[model samples]
Target: MSYYDEIEIEDMTFDPKLQIYHYPCPCGDRFEISIGDMRDGEGVGVCPSCSLMIQKRGEASNSSCGYLNAGYFSSTISSATRDLIKTKQARHI
Candidate 1:
């Protein structure tokens, strides 16, 4: 099965400073994303168990408001694959 099959997606609010996305997973794992190296529509993020690339739905908007600045305004992931991203990031770092 494709890696995508193990992941769940959703729309959510993002914070650049904290570099985290707050959401709950199907397996009861609450997680956050790192925005340090994110592009407008796609970026690498880390979770408790996994590391993965997150794709946002819409283009990034330029607004004076801090929250409206950049990153995926609405996004989500699955708990099962969440740790995969974290593992990837650890290797890079």
Candidate 2:
């Protein structure tokens, strides 16, 4: 029921296929939160097997950068972000 700590969004890994972001938990399981939950300003990442949680810090745009940097263009990342936003909106309806 209580959170262990606040984890930076930059420290988490974004799974484009799962549409979820995850960070390692101290309990050996991962702390997970969905991109949709993040977009809605939800900051809690929870470990499925435990009651522990972590507060996610930073913006979604900044976190969802697995495909960014290097030689890849910003547009591709932006497109993916747009798609994620659309998906989030669709789920609400």
Candidate 3:
């Protein structure tokens, strides 16, 4: 699975309400993935608006996001990042 770039987990934006991490995509959208999935051993944040995807590097547990004392977005990431690929078998919505 090729990605545009490898972004460190710390560089992604954490949305507490959705328990997800997001990063800006050049496609004029955002690449989003859920925090739970990250903790569950998932990587790759996909953009909702286009075919582009970004690979997540590092670990959520190592990130400084206070909400992640290690815990959980985008199956419905954000209005900007919703509907990204659900890498897991269990879909959030």
Candidate lDDT (C-alpha), each: 0.39, 0.74, 0.69
Q: By lDDT, is 1 or 2 better?
A: 2
* Candidate 3 displacement at residue 87 in angstroms: 22
Q: Encode model 1's per-residue lDDT on 2-73: one tens digit a residue.
A: 121222223545555465554444445544444434333333233455543333333223221234323233
TM-score of each: 0.36, 0.67, 0.66
Writing each residue's lDDT as its tens digit, candidate 3 over 1-93 gives: 778999998888878887788999997899999866775677979899999888888765433364422333323345332223222222522
The parts of candidate 2 lying over 4 Å away from their true place are: 66-93
For this target, which candidate reaches the highest lDDT against the unseen true structure?
A: 2
In model 2, the worst 10-residue window by lDDT is 66-75
How many clashes in each candidate?
14, 0, 4
For model 3, name the residue pairs that clash. Answer: 20-73, 34-73, 36-72, 74-77
On lDDT, the stronger of 2 and 3 is: 2
Query: Candidate 3: where are CA atoms >4 Å away?
Result: 62-64, 68-93
Error of 3 at 36 (Å): 2.0
Indicate the worst ten consecutive residues by lDDT in candidate 1: 1-10
